[model samples]
Target: MDTPQNTALMRALAEVPGPLPTSGVVHISLPHTERFTVVGNHLAQNAALSTTAVGFAVRIQSLPQGTEVGIKALAARFPEGEKLIAAALRELEAHGYLHRTRVRLPNGRMVTRTVFCNHPEALLRPRPADASKRGPALVAAPVSTQAPAPVTAPVSAQAPALVAAPVAPHVPAPASVPAHVPAPAPVTPHAPLPAPEALETPAPPPVTDRPVPAGPLPPAPPAPRLVPPPTAPKAPPRPLPQPRELTPGLQQTAVALLSDLRRHAPELVLSEADIERLAPATATWLERDAHPDTIRQALTTDLPQPVKYPAKFVRHRLTVLLPPPLPGTEELAPARPRTVVIPLQTCEGCERAFRSRTPSLCRDCRTACEQPAA
Candidate 1:
């Protein structure tokens, strides 16, 4: 090499073995293929990624894809987790080691997909190849057309000018006559042969109506009667829903609130759709955005001495004593229509209700469709 520096460096690099730690993560229990890259040589040590972040990254790697590893869950699980994890992720993303792509899930949810890299070159994503620019297809060259030159014969003294052989002139073939053709039978009028006598076919023996020994028919299953399914007895209709009969949709919302409470406070088991007994109180709680558990607590916390009929009593309390709405709730309420009417604008894509007046996809699906991939 011309340059001494290059020569020396090449020699030094040649002496040094490629990379360190040939073995992969020895822990066999790691879920999925996470162990393959967890401690691989590809994980370059970035100073920005502190010990905490590195720990967090390892934890993240071990987690299954699409798991709910939110900041809140991390904080609850580890000390100083939220801040450390956030900073670490931001640092890794800056170095192109981490990627967050908002992908539309098969279930129609818009979610961020986390793509982690052990070693990222930070290059732009490759684009699809251009069809027009493709190289020509492989094809064998055309076979040689001219016949081989005539082979030379041995010459006597001086070589003679080569004489060519003459080819015979082409002859046309004569038209062919039909094969095995019989000559016309001389147009003779011959006498007809005598008709043969008809053979007699004996008439089939007449089928006699014979008596059959019939046993009694099998006792057919009482021709299966279509008995309607037995339904659970419906509770008496709740007092005609008063003047303000809650719509089916609103009742569903109330029931959902009850279900949420059941998650945290399993003892609060009640049908979400038992709207007659639960709607007014549940609606009051939902309007304020009060956590279901908190609302349940408020209803059950300071009960009067030995309360009878817990469901009836709880319902009464929730309706009568609802906490004040959260401060910013007024702003949120404007987005909801004051008087519920069927949505005017339907989504052009899914034809779902609550599309803006101009007729577009609802917010979630709209974001999913319009979001530019990263």
Candidate 2:
């Protein structure tokens, strides 16, 4: 059976003189089941929103929760540049279809959190209008000409019962008193105060030679416990025993090596004062038959990043990792040679020096001597 509203709509449509115009849009909307978003017509047909903003808003709303809808992400996904996408986002924000806020994460990183609203009309509160200018008055004034019949109806209905009820004995009726009598004037009396001998004064505190302190002065704080000012951290103990008067030549070699350290590791660059100060330690390494390369390796390799105090670091390595002196002859035993070297001899035939195990003529002279006389 057709409902009255639907029937009326059909009749109204039938009364139209001609067929529907073919120029406008026609929707072929189908029931959505799986992956679809419902968008409100207020946003879809909004006159103030630009085409790009409308499309971007729809895309944002359809996206799954936590999906990236930032300007760069959208720009990467679509051909529209970041500028256009950002403008579209701004438009969406202005119209209340989207909100983007920079939020700081718990780990101290900043991120943009976006919120999309499908129905901006419901989500975004419209500015409240001035009551005096736009809204109708909530309270209407009562008309003076109209009688108060509704308010007086209940009282009028109970009038017979009220008139028949017996009045209480304590209750006074309006007509019981004489109308001409005047009321008595109010009376106030003042009482006499007590004699002066009844009042007593408080005694004053006793005087003492020394002034008293509040709460015993906290036991004089135990003379501050004499903390000794923390010993000043002891200044790192300067390289100890100071290399025992190194030679001028040895000192120069050490200084040259120290200055050249920058060639291998740029971070190990040393000032002139630093090089002069560390020269004795470097000379000590050389005195112990430690090669300049070995010193360089020790200082440059495995260096801490940024080497804030390069001179101090070099001093520590030099003092702590100094190699033991080479062994004495008594400590080392001689060993046999692996191979013998041929002695150089002059050839009898050509008088040219050549190496041979046995001193004799050269190969050419030997062959000539062995041949028959010719």
Candidate 3:
């Protein structure tokens, strides 16, 4: 089938240097070999249906029978969520692609039944002659068999043929199908028949807002008790640490440090009574392993010129800026050195056993022996 020019053109198109730039959509449609559903263009290109509804109809058509298509199932399967999926399903129902009805099971439980039509237009087509045997007739009088005259306009001018039309009560077929044309029936002159305009149009069916359950309604749930929320209690203020007791040596050190503060700051001169009264607070600091120079620096550094009350300033600093106590002695103390016992050896001169690096006399014996030698 290839000519020289056609082959060159095909080769050029096939041998694209790289991806070609495209402003609009470029479809690379491939034939689906598996898991494909045939959706008609009526549903796909419907102006009334939303994009979500079209996509949902395609997905539902592709799904295997008995698979869960419930709102929750769809919400879990896709990210659009239940509300949008429900709206899309309603759209499908309104457009004749889907129908949902309630059926009472043999076990006395009610369940929803769903019916899907791939080609919705077939529903409006003429029914077969045996359709009347199936159920009660929708029309009270015999249906007229006369065919409607053909219109000269195109297909779009006429109403679309429905697929899977609901079973009606002895309703006659529409005029669309030419194959079902029947011969005119003989009429008697005694009675004149009514024209098509004179015949009454069937009233529209009643609107059912929701499917009613067959059994009695369940009892109403009891009203919930309203319990008051518990009130939060106010928090109490934190307590300060109690002044620590100190040993006699620590107390003397504290008093000495306080007395030496004047050496650093001459204005920080405290009297004997003042030192004695503030000794305990300083001793508390010392008890917590506070160094002497550190305490002196705290009490003397940055002294206010001509301090009217040095004792009060020192007391306030000592109380407000007291350092936290050091960890316990067990934690702060160094690990103890391992004790090694030396083997006892006999001394060469004294013939007495003594502990030493080499054979030697004891301390007292060595001193005595060395004194005799000197």
Candidate 4:
């Protein structure tokens, strides 16, 4: 009869050997009785029987009497190999699922003897009711049985004892009288004294008339002299000089000199014609003297201004030298103002013109040009 346990064991074994099937059972006739079994093929030669009830029985029968199954042998038989089988065995031992016994081999070295429980369910089940919990248990005693004694005492015993005792009454004696008692004498009723006489007042003496001496009153203090404060010294007024207009020639010359100085030495000042004429000498003198104010004063007084007008003379000279345009020619061609308009690119960052194509000032000036005029 094939039981469920036998069937499962056979199936596991059959997986190891192809020849063994679920329905196939090998009957091995031992010398004593016929044992029904499964004969696994060569693959089963290395198959391991688990450390279970069925596995134990199978293992016993599978190995020869002298055969010793160690970790290596079990590993060869285990599906996952020896290392995994050894690990599983350790785990089972830790979980109380298996027990191990150490046996001494003939080599004098210790080996393991593993045993498996037939009923794993029983090992995993809850403990019996009679078994105590793992740790200590606390039991509380009854409070009424161990109560303390009362502290109160009987009232009559605690009270003090009182006895009857009599006290004598207090009596005060009367004060004694003096032996010699003298009575006070009676007061006499004397007669009234006479009233005091009135004092007499003397009359005042007669008045005498005496004339008071007269003296002339001194003249009233002389009237204050009204003396006015001294007038401030009067300033001398001078006659005004006639005004004169600058000659056009002088004006033109000044303008020309200013323009020339601006072109050569922009820092020079043209305060007066004399100063302008003496500018170069004054600048030279200042360089030698190291005193610019002294040069300035000398230049202002030393240079002479032109006496005659030059613009009138220049115009007359030009008119005589150059021919006048024809009457129709003048109408045909009116003079156009000649102004040199430098290209923006020619402008140096300075207001002056630059001859080079790549002006140093153009880029800087570009930013200024881009700004809105204030």
lDDT of each: 0.57, 0.73, 0.74, 0.43
Q: Pick the winner on TM-score between candidates 3 and 4.
A: 3
Best-matching candidate per TM-score:
3
- Which candidate model has the greater TM-score, 1 or 4? 1
lDDT of 1 by residue, 162-233 (tens): 434334367775576467965446432244322222222344543435544498644433332222222346
Off by over 4 Å in 4: 1-69, 103-108, 120-374
lDDT of 2 by residue, 82-183 (tens): 888988887888776676678999999999888776765552343333322554425432223422222211234534352232332585557655768766
**CA deviation > 4 Å runs, candidate 3:** 1-24, 127-374
Q: How far is 290's C-alpha from truth in model 4 (Å)?
A: 82
At residue 67, give the lDDT of candidate 2: 89
> What C-alpha RMSD separates each model from the true structure?
41.1, 31.6, 27.5, 63.3
Residue 215: error of model 2 in Å? 20
lDDT score of model 4? 0.43
- Candidate 2's TM-score reads 0.29
Please provide TM-scores, in order, for all candidate models, with all chains considered together. 0.23, 0.29, 0.30, 0.16
Ranking by TM-score: 3, 2, 1, 4
Q: Which pairs of residues have clashing backbones in candidate 1? A: 255-272
User: What's the TM for model 1?
Assistant: 0.23
Of models 2 and 4, which has the larger lDDT? 2
